[model samples]
Target: MTESNTITCEKFLPHHPAAVWKALTDPDLHARWWAAGDIRPVVGHRFTLDMGNFGSQPCEVTEVHDQRILAYRFAETTLNTTITWTLNPEGEGTRLVLTHTDFDLDSPMGRQAYDGMGRGWPHVLDRLEGVLGETPGFDEEP
Candidate 1:
């Protein structure tokens, strides 16, 4: 069996889980933080993210647990990786964990993506924090 690589990033956001969940599921908010896509939390729902210069990549929601977890198959045919977002309430905020797995280290595309995204996820999470801060009521108690 071929070994794969996984990228995990954790960020502490001073927001509620519901708010974080919205940022993950809401198309407009998600686009601002990451890529543009009709991303819903419904399992098996298909969508495509506009990766700009990287082109559009197809994705499908594979699992969702309300405001807790969201997992999906990303770039299904090409990268064939899974992206999972996990939200855990910690005191007055949410600790968001992003797990990107299934990178074929042997392939050039996968290796490149793994290398690039390893550095990119942090910046993306930073954008997510910025978006949450700008959005009204996201930082407040629900």
Candidate 2:
């Protein structure tokens, strides 16, 4: 049974907000965790995330708040969803909150994607944490 169309998750990384922010904005680091793309933290920056078998999805940066918040339009012509990543400084780490919303669950395609991504996001975030862990000097501050 499909519960909800949105995929929301929170990951507590032992890295500072600055590092987490870089991981999200930097394409190389972003690809290490998620899809490969030329993503930047500048609003209006358009990019594409190669989802392998899922094809290339067009994205446009809609909002950015330094290392605090990054929001963008994902899969413009396909999924037409909004993916927002929020970074919050917590004690000595960053609390990363991911909100992937606007899935047209009524359609089979949307349902499939929603279900698949719902399970996939946690693993993606795990990889992200792994990347940060292996970084030469990550989470060394804050």
Candidate 3:
């Protein structure tokens, strides 16, 4: 029952934008929360997110703005999705916006992929909040 071809997810971090940005770009912090290690956030770098019980994606760094924006390409699946992560300062914290473009809800596989993502992202964002010891400036459904 896929309705949209693309979806965007967002979370706000209760920390300095630079700090959250570092956690996002730095391999060490990313490994602590993202997935099975080996990732760097520099433009032109290649990385993989191995979901032990799910699947894997080989992603490549596409763009960066040094604590402001990050973009990447995931080329392991049928849909060539581009992921964009943006950070913006809000008062004393930061807002993170994640847009997974190129999702095709018109296909069976695409629908499955979209459903998987729907279940996966919030858990990681919650982990990110746990890592920061505070909830981000956003609300979630029960």
What's the lDDT for all of these models? 0.96, 0.93, 0.74
Please give the RMSD to the true structure for each candidate, in Å.
1.7, 1.8, 5.8
Top candidate when judged by lDDT against the true structure: 1
Predicted candidate 3 versus true structure: per-residue lDDT over 15-114, tens digit per residue? 8876777667766677677776466667888888776765677888899898899998875455578888899888777888888778777778777877
Q: Per-residue CA lDDT of candidate 2, range 1-142, in tens?
A: 7566789999999899999998899899999988999999899999999999999999999999998999999999989999999999899999999999999998898888999999999999999999999987785773
Q: Model 1 — TM-score against the truth?
A: 0.97
> Candidate 3, which segments miss by more than 4 Å at Cα?
1-3, 75-77, 134-142
| Model 2: per-residue Cα lDDT at residue 5 | 72
Which residue pairs overlap in candidate 2's backbone?
A: none
- In model 2, the runs with Cα more than 4 Å from the true position are 1-3
**TM-scores of all candidate predictions against the true structure:** 0.97, 0.95, 0.82
Candidate with maximal TM-score: 1
Give the lDDT of residue 77 in candidate 3. Answer: 59
